[model samples]
Target: MHRRRRTAVVVTSALLLSVPLLAACGNEARPGAAAVVGGERIEVGAVQSKVKAVRVAQERSPQAEQLVKDSGQLTRAKLYDLIVARVVEKAAEDAGVSVTRKEVQTGRAQLVGQAGGEEQLAAMYLQQRGIAPGQLEDVVRRDVLVGKLAEAIGATNGQEGQQKLNAAFSAAAATLDIDVNPRFGTWSDQDLALGEYKAPWITQVTQSQGAPVSGA
Candidate 1:
Protein backbone atom coordinates (compact mmCIF):
# COMPACT_ATOMS: atom_id res chain seq x y z
CA MET A 1 0.00 0.00 0.00
CA HIS A 2 2.91 2.34 0.75
CA ARG A 3 4.49 1.54 -2.64
CA ARG A 4 1.16 2.31 -4.39
CA ARG A 5 0.87 5.58 -2.50
CA ARG A 6 4.41 6.59 -3.47
CA THR A 7 3.70 5.82 -7.13
CA ALA A 8 0.52 7.91 -7.04
CA VAL A 9 2.43 10.85 -5.62
CA VAL A 10 5.09 10.52 -8.31
CA VAL A 11 2.45 10.40 -11.05
CA THR A 12 0.67 13.44 -9.68
CA SER A 13 3.90 15.39 -9.47
CA ALA A 14 4.75 14.53 -13.09
CA LEU A 15 1.36 15.73 -14.26
CA LEU A 16 1.68 19.01 -12.39
CA LEU A 17 5.17 19.66 -13.79
CA SER A 18 4.04 18.94 -17.35
CA VAL A 19 1.37 21.64 -17.37
CA PRO A 20 3.69 24.65 -16.93
CA LEU A 21 6.29 23.14 -19.21
CA LEU A 22 3.68 22.82 -21.97
CA ALA A 23 2.55 26.38 -21.45
CA ALA A 24 6.13 27.65 -21.52
CA CYS A 25 6.77 25.77 -24.75
CA GLY A 26 3.64 27.27 -26.33
CA ASN A 27 4.60 30.81 -25.37
CA GLU A 28 8.07 30.21 -26.66
CA ALA A 29 6.84 28.94 -30.02
CA ARG A 30 4.67 31.93 -30.86
CA PRO A 31 5.84 34.62 -28.51
CA GLY A 32 4.00 37.94 -28.95
CA ALA A 33 2.05 36.69 -31.93
CA ALA A 34 -1.71 36.34 -32.06
CA ALA A 35 -1.11 34.19 -35.14
CA VAL A 36 1.37 33.55 -37.92
CA VAL A 37 0.12 33.38 -41.48
CA GLY A 38 2.35 32.55 -44.42
CA GLY A 39 5.38 33.09 -42.22
CA GLU A 40 4.17 36.59 -41.24
CA ARG A 41 3.48 37.22 -37.58
CA ILE A 42 0.20 38.87 -36.60
CA GLU A 43 1.33 40.44 -33.37
CA VAL A 44 -0.79 40.43 -30.24
CA GLY A 45 -0.07 44.16 -29.97
CA ALA A 46 -1.66 44.73 -33.38
CA VAL A 47 -4.80 42.90 -32.27
CA GLN A 48 -4.97 45.00 -29.11
CA SER A 49 -4.59 48.19 -31.12
CA LYS A 50 -7.54 47.24 -33.30
CA VAL A 51 -9.63 46.35 -30.26
CA LYS A 52 -8.73 49.65 -28.69
CA ALA A 53 -9.88 51.51 -31.78
CA VAL A 54 -13.24 49.76 -31.75
CA ARG A 55 -13.64 50.29 -28.03
CA VAL A 56 -12.94 53.99 -28.39
CA ALA A 57 -15.53 54.25 -31.13
CA GLN A 58 -18.05 52.19 -29.14
CA GLU A 59 -17.58 54.41 -26.10
CA ARG A 60 -18.49 57.47 -28.11
CA SER A 61 -21.76 55.92 -29.25
CA PRO A 62 -25.02 56.17 -27.28
CA GLN A 63 -25.29 52.36 -27.21
CA ALA A 64 -21.88 52.05 -25.65
CA GLU A 65 -22.93 49.51 -23.03
CA GLN A 66 -24.66 47.27 -25.53
CA LEU A 67 -21.80 47.51 -28.00
CA VAL A 68 -19.28 46.51 -25.38
CA LYS A 69 -21.48 43.62 -24.26
CA ASP A 70 -21.92 42.36 -27.82
CA SER A 71 -18.20 42.37 -28.58
CA GLY A 72 -16.95 40.53 -25.51
CA GLN A 73 -14.64 38.53 -27.77
CA LEU A 74 -13.27 41.65 -29.45
CA THR A 75 -9.67 40.54 -29.22
CA ARG A 76 -10.29 37.22 -30.88
CA ALA A 77 -12.59 38.80 -33.44
CA LYS A 78 -9.94 41.34 -34.41
CA LEU A 79 -7.33 38.62 -34.67
CA TYR A 80 -9.68 36.58 -36.82
CA ASP A 81 -10.23 39.59 -39.06
CA LEU A 82 -6.50 40.04 -39.46
CA ILE A 83 -6.06 36.39 -40.38
CA VAL A 84 -8.90 36.59 -42.89
CA ALA A 85 -7.38 39.70 -44.43
CA ARG A 86 -4.19 37.80 -45.15
CA VAL A 87 -6.18 34.87 -46.49
CA VAL A 88 -8.12 37.15 -48.81
CA GLU A 89 -4.93 38.78 -50.00
CA LYS A 90 -3.40 35.40 -50.77
CA ALA A 91 -6.47 34.24 -52.69
CA ALA A 92 -6.63 37.50 -54.60
CA GLU A 93 -2.97 37.29 -55.53
CA ASP A 94 -3.37 33.71 -56.67
CA ALA A 95 -6.21 34.77 -58.97
CA GLY A 96 -4.38 37.85 -60.29
CA VAL A 97 -6.88 40.08 -58.48
CA SER A 98 -6.14 43.42 -56.90
CA VAL A 99 -7.98 46.44 -55.49
CA THR A 100 -6.88 49.96 -56.17
CA ARG A 101 -7.09 52.74 -53.58
CA LYS A 102 -9.52 54.52 -55.85
CA GLU A 103 -11.75 51.47 -55.85
CA VAL A 104 -11.80 51.42 -52.08
CA GLN A 105 -12.64 55.11 -51.99
CA THR A 106 -15.45 54.58 -54.46
CA GLY A 107 -16.83 51.68 -52.49
CA ARG A 108 -16.73 53.65 -49.24
CA ALA A 109 -18.45 56.56 -50.91
CA GLN A 110 -21.22 54.28 -52.15
CA LEU A 111 -21.72 52.79 -48.70
CA VAL A 112 -21.88 56.26 -47.11
CA GLY A 113 -24.51 57.31 -49.61
CA GLN A 114 -26.55 54.22 -48.93
CA ALA A 115 -26.29 54.67 -45.17
CA GLY A 116 -27.45 58.33 -45.55
CA GLY A 117 -24.30 60.03 -44.24
CA GLU A 118 -20.87 59.58 -42.64
CA GLU A 119 -22.25 59.20 -39.09
CA GLN A 120 -24.91 56.72 -40.12
CA LEU A 121 -22.37 54.71 -42.08
CA ALA A 122 -20.04 54.70 -39.10
CA ALA A 123 -22.83 53.62 -36.76
CA MET A 124 -24.00 50.91 -39.14
CA TYR A 125 -20.53 49.47 -39.52
CA LEU A 126 -19.84 49.66 -35.79
CA GLN A 127 -23.12 48.00 -34.89
CA GLN A 128 -23.11 45.30 -37.56
CA ARG A 129 -19.39 44.59 -38.03
CA GLY A 130 -17.60 45.86 -34.90
CA ILE A 131 -15.50 48.20 -37.02
CA ALA A 132 -14.28 51.60 -35.93
CA PRO A 133 -14.87 54.58 -38.22
CA GLY A 134 -11.15 54.81 -38.86
CA GLN A 135 -10.94 51.12 -39.76
CA LEU A 136 -13.83 51.21 -42.23
CA GLU A 137 -11.49 51.82 -45.16
CA ASP A 138 -9.61 48.59 -44.60
CA VAL A 139 -12.85 46.64 -44.41
CA VAL A 140 -14.10 48.32 -47.58
CA ARG A 141 -10.85 47.49 -49.32
CA ARG A 142 -11.22 43.83 -48.34
CA ASP A 143 -14.77 43.83 -49.65
CA VAL A 144 -13.62 45.24 -52.95
CA LEU A 145 -10.91 42.63 -53.16
CA VAL A 146 -13.41 39.83 -52.50
CA GLY A 147 -15.71 41.15 -55.19
CA LYS A 148 -12.90 41.39 -57.71
CA LEU A 149 -11.63 37.97 -56.65
CA ALA A 150 -15.08 36.51 -57.22
CA GLU A 151 -15.12 38.03 -60.67
CA ALA A 152 -11.63 36.86 -61.54
CA ILE A 153 -12.38 33.30 -60.47
CA GLY A 154 -15.61 33.21 -62.48
CA ALA A 155 -17.63 32.71 -59.30
CA THR A 156 -21.29 33.53 -59.96
CA ASN A 157 -24.09 34.83 -57.76
CA GLY A 158 -25.43 31.60 -56.32
CA GLN A 159 -24.80 28.96 -53.64
CA GLU A 160 -22.61 26.97 -56.01
CA GLY A 161 -20.54 30.05 -56.71
CA GLN A 162 -20.23 30.88 -53.04
CA GLN A 163 -18.97 27.37 -52.40
CA LYS A 164 -16.41 27.77 -55.14
CA LEU A 165 -15.24 31.07 -53.66
CA ASN A 166 -15.01 29.47 -50.22
CA ALA A 167 -12.94 26.64 -51.65
CA ALA A 168 -10.54 29.17 -53.13
CA PHE A 169 -10.15 30.92 -49.77
CA SER A 170 -9.72 27.57 -47.99
CA ALA A 171 -6.99 26.62 -50.43
CA ALA A 172 -5.25 29.93 -49.83
CA ALA A 173 -5.55 29.53 -46.05
CA ALA A 174 -4.06 26.04 -46.20
CA THR A 175 -1.04 27.29 -48.10
CA LEU A 176 -0.39 29.96 -45.44
CA ASP A 177 0.48 27.39 -42.72
CA ILE A 178 -1.38 29.50 -40.16
CA ASP A 179 -0.31 28.91 -36.56
CA VAL A 180 -2.52 30.64 -34.00
CA ASN A 181 -1.80 31.09 -30.32
CA PRO A 182 -3.66 28.36 -28.46
CA ARG A 183 -4.89 30.87 -25.91
CA PHE A 184 -6.97 32.52 -28.63
CA GLY A 185 -7.95 29.31 -30.44
CA THR A 186 -7.01 26.88 -33.22
CA TRP A 187 -6.75 27.88 -36.83
CA SER A 188 -8.82 25.90 -39.31
CA ASP A 189 -7.33 26.16 -42.79
CA GLN A 190 -10.01 23.82 -44.07
CA ASP A 191 -12.89 25.91 -42.77
CA LEU A 192 -10.90 29.15 -42.98
CA ALA A 193 -11.87 29.81 -39.38
CA LEU A 194 -10.32 30.58 -36.02
CA GLY A 195 -11.83 28.21 -33.45
CA GLU A 196 -15.55 28.88 -32.97
CA TYR A 197 -15.47 31.67 -35.53
CA LYS A 198 -16.58 30.26 -38.85
CA ALA A 199 -15.31 32.01 -41.98
CA PRO A 200 -17.51 34.77 -43.37
CA TRP A 201 -19.35 34.13 -46.58
CA ILE A 202 -18.21 35.69 -49.85
CA THR A 203 -20.51 38.30 -51.31
CA GLN A 204 -21.40 37.89 -54.98
CA VAL A 205 -19.69 40.30 -57.30
CA THR A 206 -23.08 41.08 -58.80
CA GLN A 207 -24.25 42.48 -55.46
CA SER A 208 -21.27 44.73 -54.84
CA GLN A 209 -22.87 47.70 -56.57
CA GLY A 210 -26.13 47.42 -54.64
CA ALA A 211 -24.64 47.43 -51.12
CA PRO A 212 -21.41 46.95 -49.23
CA VAL A 213 -20.07 43.51 -50.06
CA SER A 214 -19.00 42.21 -46.65
CA GLY A 215 -16.70 39.39 -45.61
CA ALA A 216 -14.38 38.61 -42.77
Candidate 2:
Protein backbone atom coordinates (compact mmCIF):
# COMPACT_ATOMS: atom_id res chain seq x y z
CA MET A 1 0.00 0.00 0.00
CA HIS A 2 2.87 2.39 0.80
CA ARG A 3 4.54 1.65 -2.56
CA ARG A 4 1.33 2.58 -4.44
CA ARG A 5 1.04 5.83 -2.49
CA ARG A 6 4.65 6.76 -3.24
CA THR A 7 4.13 6.06 -6.97
CA ALA A 8 1.05 8.25 -7.05
CA VAL A 9 2.93 11.19 -5.47
CA VAL A 10 5.77 10.77 -7.98
CA VAL A 11 3.30 10.95 -10.88
CA THR A 12 1.65 14.04 -9.49
CA SER A 13 5.00 15.79 -9.06
CA ALA A 14 5.96 14.89 -12.63
CA LEU A 15 2.78 16.45 -13.94
CA LEU A 16 3.28 19.55 -11.84
CA LEU A 17 6.74 20.03 -13.34
CA SER A 18 5.41 19.41 -16.85
CA VAL A 19 2.76 22.15 -16.60
CA PRO A 20 5.10 25.01 -17.58
CA LEU A 21 6.50 22.97 -20.44
CA LEU A 22 2.98 22.46 -21.75
CA ALA A 23 2.41 26.21 -21.87
CA ALA A 24 5.49 26.78 -24.03
CA CYS A 25 4.46 23.88 -26.25
CA GLY A 26 1.04 25.40 -26.69
CA ASN A 27 2.61 28.54 -28.20
CA GLU A 28 4.87 26.50 -30.46
CA ALA A 29 2.02 24.31 -31.62
CA ARG A 30 0.13 27.27 -32.95
CA PRO A 31 2.40 28.06 -35.91
CA GLY A 32 -0.44 28.61 -38.31
CA ALA A 33 -2.52 31.65 -37.32
CA ALA A 34 -1.08 34.90 -38.68
CA ALA A 35 -2.47 36.54 -35.61
CA VAL A 36 -4.55 35.49 -32.64
CA VAL A 37 -6.59 38.56 -31.70
CA GLY A 38 -8.40 38.30 -28.39
CA GLY A 39 -9.76 34.79 -29.02
CA GLU A 40 -10.14 34.82 -32.81
CA ARG A 41 -7.63 33.19 -35.11
CA ILE A 42 -6.81 35.33 -38.13
CA GLU A 43 -5.67 32.52 -40.38
CA VAL A 44 -2.56 32.78 -42.54
CA GLY A 45 -4.39 31.35 -45.52
CA ALA A 46 -7.08 34.02 -45.25
CA VAL A 47 -4.49 36.80 -45.01
CA GLN A 48 -2.72 35.57 -48.11
CA SER A 49 -6.03 35.27 -49.91
CA LYS A 50 -6.78 38.89 -49.12
CA VAL A 51 -3.32 39.87 -50.29
CA LYS A 52 -4.03 38.24 -53.61
CA ALA A 53 -7.35 40.01 -53.90
CA VAL A 54 -5.74 43.38 -53.21
CA ARG A 55 -3.08 42.81 -55.85
CA VAL A 56 -5.75 41.83 -58.34
CA ALA A 57 -7.71 44.94 -57.55
CA GLN A 58 -4.73 47.14 -58.31
CA GLU A 59 -4.28 45.52 -61.71
CA ARG A 60 -6.54 48.09 -63.38
CA SER A 61 -4.06 50.90 -62.88
CA PRO A 62 -1.79 51.97 -65.77
CA GLN A 63 1.01 51.89 -63.23
CA ALA A 64 0.36 48.28 -62.20
CA GLU A 65 3.86 47.09 -63.06
CA GLN A 66 5.55 49.73 -60.94
CA LEU A 67 3.17 49.00 -58.10
CA VAL A 68 3.88 45.28 -58.35
CA LYS A 69 7.61 45.90 -58.25
CA ASP A 70 7.12 47.99 -55.13
CA SER A 71 6.78 44.60 -53.37
CA GLY A 72 3.01 44.25 -53.55
CA GLN A 73 3.15 46.70 -50.67
CA LEU A 74 -0.54 47.27 -50.13
CA THR A 75 -1.04 43.53 -49.69
CA ARG A 76 1.76 43.29 -47.16
CA ALA A 77 1.06 46.40 -45.10
CA LYS A 78 -2.72 46.59 -45.39
CA LEU A 79 -3.23 43.07 -44.12
CA TYR A 80 -1.44 44.06 -40.95
CA ASP A 81 -3.44 47.29 -40.85
CA LEU A 82 -6.67 45.37 -41.32
CA ILE A 83 -5.87 43.13 -38.35
CA VAL A 84 -5.11 46.11 -36.11
CA ALA A 85 -8.12 47.97 -37.48
CA ARG A 86 -10.38 45.10 -36.48
CA VAL A 87 -9.12 45.45 -32.92
CA VAL A 88 -10.03 49.16 -33.04
CA GLU A 89 -13.45 48.29 -34.40
CA LYS A 90 -14.06 46.09 -31.36
CA ALA A 91 -13.04 48.93 -29.07
CA ALA A 92 -15.32 51.30 -30.95
CA GLU A 93 -18.23 48.94 -30.44
CA ASP A 94 -17.52 48.77 -26.72
CA ALA A 95 -17.50 52.57 -26.62
CA GLY A 96 -20.97 52.56 -28.13
CA VAL A 97 -19.84 54.25 -31.33
CA SER A 98 -20.47 53.18 -34.89
CA VAL A 99 -20.36 54.51 -38.44
CA THR A 100 -22.73 53.82 -41.27
CA ARG A 101 -22.41 53.52 -45.05
CA LYS A 102 -24.22 56.80 -45.46
CA GLU A 103 -21.75 58.54 -43.19
CA VAL A 104 -18.86 57.14 -45.22
CA GLN A 105 -20.50 58.23 -48.44
CA THR A 106 -21.38 61.65 -47.16
CA GLY A 107 -17.93 62.26 -45.74
CA ARG A 108 -16.36 60.99 -48.93
CA ALA A 109 -18.57 63.21 -51.02
CA GLN A 110 -17.59 66.25 -48.99
CA LEU A 111 -13.93 65.35 -49.45
CA VAL A 112 -14.55 64.90 -53.15
CA GLY A 113 -16.12 68.35 -53.34
CA GLN A 114 -13.29 69.85 -51.35
CA ALA A 115 -10.70 68.20 -53.62
CA GLY A 116 -12.39 69.90 -56.60
CA GLY A 117 -14.83 67.03 -57.24
CA GLU A 118 -14.93 63.34 -58.26
CA GLU A 119 -12.37 63.41 -61.06
CA GLN A 120 -9.78 65.05 -58.84
CA LEU A 121 -10.34 62.52 -56.05
CA ALA A 122 -10.01 59.71 -58.61
CA ALA A 123 -6.73 61.12 -59.84
CA MET A 124 -5.49 61.44 -56.28
CA TYR A 125 -6.39 57.90 -55.23
CA LEU A 126 -5.88 55.97 -58.44
CA GLN A 127 -3.21 57.82 -60.34
CA GLN A 128 -1.04 59.31 -57.63
CA ARG A 129 -1.76 56.87 -54.81
CA GLY A 130 -2.32 53.77 -56.96
CA ILE A 131 -5.25 52.89 -54.73
CA ALA A 132 -8.43 51.61 -56.26
CA PRO A 133 -11.74 53.37 -55.50
CA GLY A 134 -12.95 50.30 -53.65
CA GLN A 135 -9.79 50.27 -51.58
CA LEU A 136 -10.20 53.96 -50.82
CA GLU A 137 -13.72 53.23 -49.61
CA ASP A 138 -12.37 50.67 -47.16
CA VAL A 139 -9.99 53.32 -45.83
CA VAL A 140 -12.92 55.72 -45.51
CA ARG A 141 -14.85 53.19 -43.44
CA ARG A 142 -12.06 52.82 -40.89
CA ASP A 143 -11.50 56.57 -40.82
CA VAL A 144 -15.18 57.23 -40.12
CA LEU A 145 -15.26 54.70 -37.27
CA VAL A 146 -12.17 56.23 -35.69
CA GLY A 147 -13.56 59.75 -35.99
CA LYS A 148 -16.93 58.77 -34.52
CA LEU A 149 -15.32 56.87 -31.68
CA ALA A 150 -13.04 59.78 -30.94
CA GLU A 151 -15.94 62.23 -30.86
CA ALA A 152 -18.01 60.01 -28.58
CA ILE A 153 -15.11 59.89 -26.14
CA GLY A 154 -14.73 63.74 -26.13
CA ALA A 155 -11.88 63.67 -28.60
CA THR A 156 -13.87 65.49 -31.24
CA ASN A 157 -11.86 68.47 -32.40
CA GLY A 158 -8.65 68.99 -34.28
CA GLN A 159 -5.60 66.77 -33.73
CA GLU A 160 -6.51 66.51 -30.06
CA GLY A 161 -9.31 64.10 -30.79
CA GLN A 162 -7.08 62.08 -33.09
CA GLN A 163 -4.45 61.89 -30.38
CA LYS A 164 -7.08 60.87 -27.86
CA LEU A 165 -8.33 58.22 -30.23
CA ASN A 166 -4.80 56.89 -30.52
CA ALA A 167 -4.53 56.73 -26.73
CA ALA A 168 -7.86 54.94 -26.45
CA PHE A 169 -6.91 52.37 -29.06
CA SER A 170 -3.55 51.82 -27.46
CA ALA A 171 -5.18 51.18 -24.11
CA ALA A 172 -7.68 48.82 -25.71
CA ALA A 173 -4.94 46.94 -27.55
CA ALA A 174 -2.85 46.61 -24.40
CA THR A 175 -5.60 44.76 -22.57
CA LEU A 176 -5.74 41.98 -25.16
CA ASP A 177 -3.51 38.98 -25.61
CA ILE A 178 -2.06 39.20 -29.10
CA ASP A 179 0.35 36.99 -31.03
CA VAL A 180 1.69 37.21 -34.54
CA ASN A 181 3.25 34.50 -36.64
CA PRO A 182 6.95 35.29 -37.06
CA ARG A 183 6.59 35.22 -40.83
CA PHE A 184 4.13 38.10 -40.65
CA GLY A 185 6.14 39.74 -37.87
CA THR A 186 5.17 41.49 -34.64
CA TRP A 187 2.46 43.76 -33.36
CA SER A 188 3.67 47.11 -32.07
CA ASP A 189 2.01 48.29 -28.89
CA GLN A 190 3.29 51.83 -29.46
CA ASP A 191 1.57 52.19 -32.81
CA LEU A 192 -1.20 49.70 -32.14
CA ALA A 193 -0.08 48.45 -35.53
CA LEU A 194 1.67 45.43 -37.01
CA GLY A 195 4.79 45.33 -39.14
CA GLU A 196 7.63 42.96 -39.93
CA TYR A 197 10.01 42.63 -37.04
CA LYS A 198 13.59 43.77 -37.38
CA ALA A 199 16.28 42.70 -35.01
CA PRO A 200 17.61 45.81 -33.27
CA TRP A 201 21.02 46.91 -34.37
CA ILE A 202 23.10 50.01 -34.01
CA THR A 203 22.69 51.99 -37.20
CA GLN A 204 25.66 54.10 -36.27
CA VAL A 205 28.12 53.92 -33.42
CA THR A 206 29.88 57.10 -32.37
CA GLN A 207 32.82 57.55 -30.08
CA SER A 208 33.30 60.70 -28.03
CA GLN A 209 36.54 62.61 -28.43
CA GLY A 210 39.57 60.41 -27.56
CA ALA A 211 37.43 57.29 -27.26
CA PRO A 212 38.53 54.09 -28.92
CA VAL A 213 36.26 52.04 -31.16
CA SER A 214 36.98 48.41 -31.87
CA GLY A 215 35.36 45.80 -34.04
CA ALA A 216 35.88 42.07 -34.03
TM-score, per-candidate, Cα-based: 0.83, 0.63
Model 2 off-target regions past 4 Å?
Answer: 1-28, 111-123, 126-133, 156-162, 195-216
What lDDT does model 1 reach? Answer: 0.70
Q: Superposing every Cα of model 2 onto the true structure, what RMSD results?
A: 20.6
Tens digit of per-residue lDDT, candidate 1, span 183-211 = 77687877666666553434443432344
Best-fitting candidate, scored by TM-score = 1
Q: lDDT of candidate 2 vs native?
A: 0.51
Worst 10 residues of 1 by lDDT: 8-17
* Candidate 1 regions with alpha-carbon error over 4 angstroms: 1-25, 199-209, 213-216
